[model samples]
Target chain A: MNDAQAPIVPAVEVLAFDIFGTVVDWHGSIVRELGRRYPQVDGDAFALAWRAGYKPAMVRVMSGELGWTLIDDLHRMILDAILPQFGLERLGEEERRELNRVWHRLDPWPDAVAGLQRLKRKYLLCTLSNGNLGLLTRMAKRAGLPWDCVLSAEVFRAYKPDPATYLGVARVFDVPPDRVMLVAAHHDDLAAARACGLRTAYVVRPLEFGPAHPKDVAPQAGNDLHSRDLLHLADLLDC
Target chain B: MNDAQAPIVPAVEVLAFDIFGTVVDWHGSIVRELGRRYPQVDGDAFALAWRAGYKPAMVRVMSGELGWTLIDDLHRMILDAILPQFGLERLGEEERRELNRVWHRLDPWPDAVAGLQRLKRKYLLCTLSNGNLGLLTRMAKRAGLPWDCVLSAEVFRAYKPDPATYLGVARVFDVPPDRVMLVAAHHDDLAAARACGLRTAYVVRPLEFGPAHPKDVAPQAGNDLHSRDLLHLADLLDC
Candidate 1:
């Protein structure tokens, strides 16, 4: 909960990360890119609206209302629905497609690259995000995030909060679930991983929803560790 | 077939690689490790024997004679079977497990890392191996192989030469099959990839089976490109 009371580091062999808001600043990235491309658009509101559709879209697929769909396709569906509301329905096919790939090019938080590099020296690092493999791979390449392995819900055919997604990391490494740590900014994602028996490291990303909506960064009850950001996480883990 | 008559490079967005014999020297690595660990044993014969069981083991899983098994498990099965013949039946469980993981610590060919770094600058690079994700990920991490993504038969629930495995690479990147190139030392693998409409680059690994059994590094028909090794392939691609 605090530096003075930091828990003893668990013997975690792999650190599985959540990508969208945890590793990359999706809200800030979308807002910046949208404003640059379409000056007249309310990028802040547009960014929020686009992301607001994400959970429900995944729910649709999970509920079988939609067949198995990739996050890229889901993003496009959300984009198409919100375009007219943002007065951008006139965007061309190529532009809309490129815009959708912005998710693949989202920038990392300031401390992310450095922290991951430090952590990489000590443990196997991977992504356990709901983002598809292609998106995570391209994003890591673009952002210079040095991931030892790029994993996604696509690999498991199930999204976050599913026991399969969390346990899949342990299965991949042939380790017990407790030997894998879920490093995430969201409590729900960590809770799901915890429920699956993984260690959890809570990373505070206060501006994950952008400055207009600050997220609570308070330490939660079940997490094994808490840190201000990935840098602090690396330090806390003694990386 | 030769540099004087090298085929024009195909327009590929992703370079998917075959791991075991192509990128890393499993035979050599095992031979060296076994010789070091068991001075009384004929390491060369032991290495070949262990490898000889690989295909048959996969066939059992593929034919549903056994449930879907990871390479790590397959390797252990082979090790357990061959240990008696090699007088290693006395090996403890922990030792057998560690020996089985030698597959994960195989040494990369000298040019692999450098050539991959060069190619990484131009294309999305990933492993499309029949090796399970855990083995491939550990091998890449230990050997300093910079893979953008680690894909495996485990992810597809299918093994090499399966159309699903070949096509899965293209599907992962949302690219047309021809826009994905399969680079491998094995003719059968390239042929399988080619049949799935993917481009093929034949990388010669003459020492894959050890100097006592040097493989013929001939450029076969239907392969889009051929090279002495990964470095030469990088050169042919202007990487």
Candidate 2:
């Protein structure tokens, strides 16, 4: 192995998992949920646009153009904006409100629960998600994610890729950044975590965008560990 | 029943618990942990002085005499001031720091885990404590206290009996005050909760102050439900 990719390993105490695409199959859940309500509209496109709106919406908050808004509200804002474009604006306020809660009931990837159970035995497990506290809490209840603590952008009033969201996990547990490793699917997420001095574990979620879009399977530069899934990462960590 | 004694139970969806004396035996844990390190000192009296400093320290933050300080830091402040009084200032800084974490490992009341588990079946359970997020998270892990989310005064930057703490739980879930219940042992805590329109459940912890002080077991004026312990409250809630 080259010196640049020597794999920086440390005695990790806390494993903060990025929840949405990393643990739960958000695309699958959103597509399925949107399909149920809007049969006339293309569910895949609807789900894609809804999620695509997320980062830009959060950027408004990060840039201080907007106040600290919960991801639930952000999801709703995106949903409201796109529904009329997709010819699904007939949905009432209450229906749209209920549909936005699909984020709260996203199904966990099959291996997530067992892998978390294994990793949890060895290290403290927490959700360091962009999802708000209410969304994360309801998701934990629905999917039984077994998080020791459900932390969110809501807690720090900042979204992911922000330094506060990554470092906030360490601050919550009073642990150093090095001891708090962020296990995530996306290279950008891990990159942000690494920049914040946290160790990074990259798990490939090929089905993150559903069976058709098998993206981000290969390892990127600077990840401490790269594996096929959360279970594979757990095995790599000797959990 | 008179108007003052009337029951005001609304259909509740969430139950927020007070941890220190209500859910966990802080005095017992503090006395035991202190006794191990400082056998020469009166552990009971030391524990009392340390706890007695808690509200005053929190008051400093609330009154803006001090800025937003976590209970962990507040506890350390009290510990440092009283250590010389108890003649245990000889303990090194590292040892003192580790000992301060005893608050993080306090033993839950015998019925807390089971009762919380029972309550979890029916209602969303959370911790609404003066303790910091880190302290509460560690205590939950050690004691197997199953909280849907562990919240604290640190979250709102305000301590208990403050309207912010009680109303904060409702805000987290986006529920009305009547749909959220405050499960605490102290009447002052419940009274504050009631004034904010939250339903109140009183759980009596008989040995909260140890055997010599069997205190505050009687039902108060405004509690919606009063019970012998958390198990009894779970029974009362039909969870």
Candidate 3:
């Protein structure tokens, strides 16, 4: 296939990643960590329920109902609310803090490290995530994600799907939005980036939610590129 | 010789770097690049004069005399101010802009890559630089800097030596200030970081300026650690 850098497309100077499910296997990593720590609990259910609370928590911040909260604090808020329901309330504060850091230790999808290296050679690569700088930095350290830089909504004090968050990547690199392609698994994230004039690359993470949660595999319209995974995106970009 | 983690000191969780003279040989690199591009001009004088304008320009942003400006822009501002003094006023806008990007391609000091890799094993290594995110990211790409995150004064809209910039590293990692150490060649930078309760590691950069600029070779008071270079710091930290 012709690379995304073919003459027909606008030249992209930077490739910003959405992170979480898009780059790291968040659900699997969470479930595995939870299961390992709490063998008695249904880790799958806990992981899903915890993740389910993420956006709504951000909405509170985004809508001005809640003051600005770091992902670490927000993740703890959800974890605390759901722990008792799962009978894991017996965990001590230190243990809860340790568990909350599981997000900081997520395993990269098998392709992520290698794929990013390839893409990074040709284009500037960075994280354009809702994750806080601390969380993203720790995750990159633990997972060996070779990002040129780790950028976050915490820097902009805005959440993903917010135009500022999408456009902020462009701002950081001082590139036009069209010269920055957001590569992500989520349609909404790509849509937001596109709305803000960024080129979008949609990659399918079929098991992003594990087997129980069926995800859309179809490529969305208006995306500049689509791929099976980051390696494929690397191939498509001739990286 | 124990790792910096020895019982005598606070357990530093993050090692934030001061780039430019500390990590990259800015004087040598800038002089070399400038000399390569403009053999007719005195690159040494140009380089020193360029740097000489840096702090005063930053003072504008820091004191609200001017709004927040990225170092790249400020560097250009300095470059333009000194161009006429060097009889290089005829340099076009595009050439001046291209030349301004020389800051982004600084060559790392010999031990930086290996030392940083070692430090990364034990500490969350990051760039706590006044350079804008774009410049830092590009420098990392060019120099193989293994920063876990590239943070900037731009993120806080405050320049270094400010309380906000020092405390901001700890805030990013959600660690105590003492758990974050500022590693730099500049006593003033380390002094400010220490005042904010951050641990400090002062590394000597003997030739940060060309032979003409005799820098202070003695260690300053208040720094928690002293090293000949990053490799020595890595050894001291037991990384």
Candidate 4:
């Protein structure tokens, strides 16, 4: 690796994680659930379509078109809109509510639990997800993700890519932004956290979307560390 | 026990804890630490004075006399004020800072960890304390308190006895108020949660102010459950 690409070790006291794609297999979890419920449907396409609606829904709330809404509500709205398109509009309110909660039941990446246990010995670990606190709490309990704290956009009343969410983690811990590192699978999240003066570590989740549509795992220029997965990130951090 | 004194079981989905004197032994912990540092001083009196400053400090913030300040700052303010009276004003900045963090290092009650582990299997566990998120998180990490969520008055911008802090627990989980139980040693905290339509569990912490001053452990009229300690609460909850 070139000098610019080498990992820059700073004085990091906290690690804030991006939950959905970085720590958990959201798309794969959704696809598996959908396949179980409706074997005839194209589960992959449905999973992708549901996730595709996430950003725009968040944009509406961020732009104040809708009053502050939790990710659970946003997921339900998206699920309701896409169910008819997938010819599954017959699902009842209870079914839809249960289906919408698939986000809470997303399976963690294989390295996530063990890697977190290792890194948690050295630094504070928290979720910096757009997911609501309840959702994050349930997910952590179910997945055995040993987070020192669970923070959400619901807490800051702002979503990721917004500076408040990234900066809020540091403020909660009473630490400078540079002492907190944002660990994620997405470059956009790392960039936003970096913009807020936080250190950044990118862990590539190649199958974030699924096997058919692999996410780009290329190392971005400004991130302090880049690794194949969470375990690799732990190794790089000397955990 | 009479009808009013008997445990009234409810479908509580979450157990919201009052951290300081409930799950942890703040007075005992503070006195022990203070005794170790200032061997010639009256550590019990010093500890009580420090804790006595807590509610009034929170009242200042709650009454809008002060801006939204964290408990950590309040502790520091109280520490600085009481140091002179205790003949410990000779301590420097770094020593003072470390001393102020005694709250973060307070040990849990003997049954706190095991009782919480059992209750956690049956219900979601969270802290609903006036303590700041950082303090609670650090305390949990140090004392091995397994909270699914670390909530604080800082999150609600209001301290205990505020309806916002009580109802906020239910709102976070998208559950009705009764599904969230406030488990506290203080009657006022439990009463506030009850007034907000939440279930209330009162745990007795008789030595909260140290062995010289035992707190009243009489069962209140309104609490749905009363127990000698957290382990008893776990048994009452059928956990």
**Per-model DockQ against the true two-chain complex:** 0.84, 0.78, 0.87, 0.82
Give the clashing residue pairs of candidate 3, or none: B4-B237
lDDT of 2 by residue, B86-149 (tens): 9888878998899999999999988889989998998999999999898998899989999999
List model 2's recovered fraction of native interface contacts, to 2 decimals.
0.71
Number of the predicted model whose TM-score against the real structure is largest: 1
Candidate 1 wrong stretches, greater than 4 Å? A1-7, B1-7
* TM-score of the second chain of model 4 compared to its true counterpart: 0.96
Candidate with more favorable, higher DockQ: 1 or 4: 1
Q: Give the Å shift of residue A44 in candidate 1.
A: 0.6
Q: What is the C-alpha lDDT profile of model 4 across A28-122, one tens digit per residue?
A: 89999998888888989999999999999999999999999999999999999999899999999999999999999999999999989988988
Fill in the DockQ of model 4.
0.82
Candidate 3 lDDT, tens digit per residue, A93-180? 9999999999999999999999999988988899999999999988898888999989899999899999998888888888888999
Return the TM-score for each candidate structure: 0.97, 0.96, 0.97, 0.96
Question: Candidate 2 residues A49-147, lDDT tens each?
Answer: 888998999899999999888898989999999989998788899999999999999999999998899888878889999998888999999898888
Residue B92's C-alpha lDDT in candidate 3? 100
Best first by TM-score, ranked: 1, 3, 4, 2
Candidate 4, Cα interface RMSD: 0.6
- Regions of model 4 farther than 4 Å from truth: A1-7, B1-7
Query: Which scores higher on DockQ, 1 or 3?
Result: 3
Better of 1 and 2 by TM-score: 1
Cα lDDT for residue B155, candidate 1 = 86
Query: Which regions in candidate 3 have their CA more than 4 angstroms from the true location?
Result: A1-10, B1-7
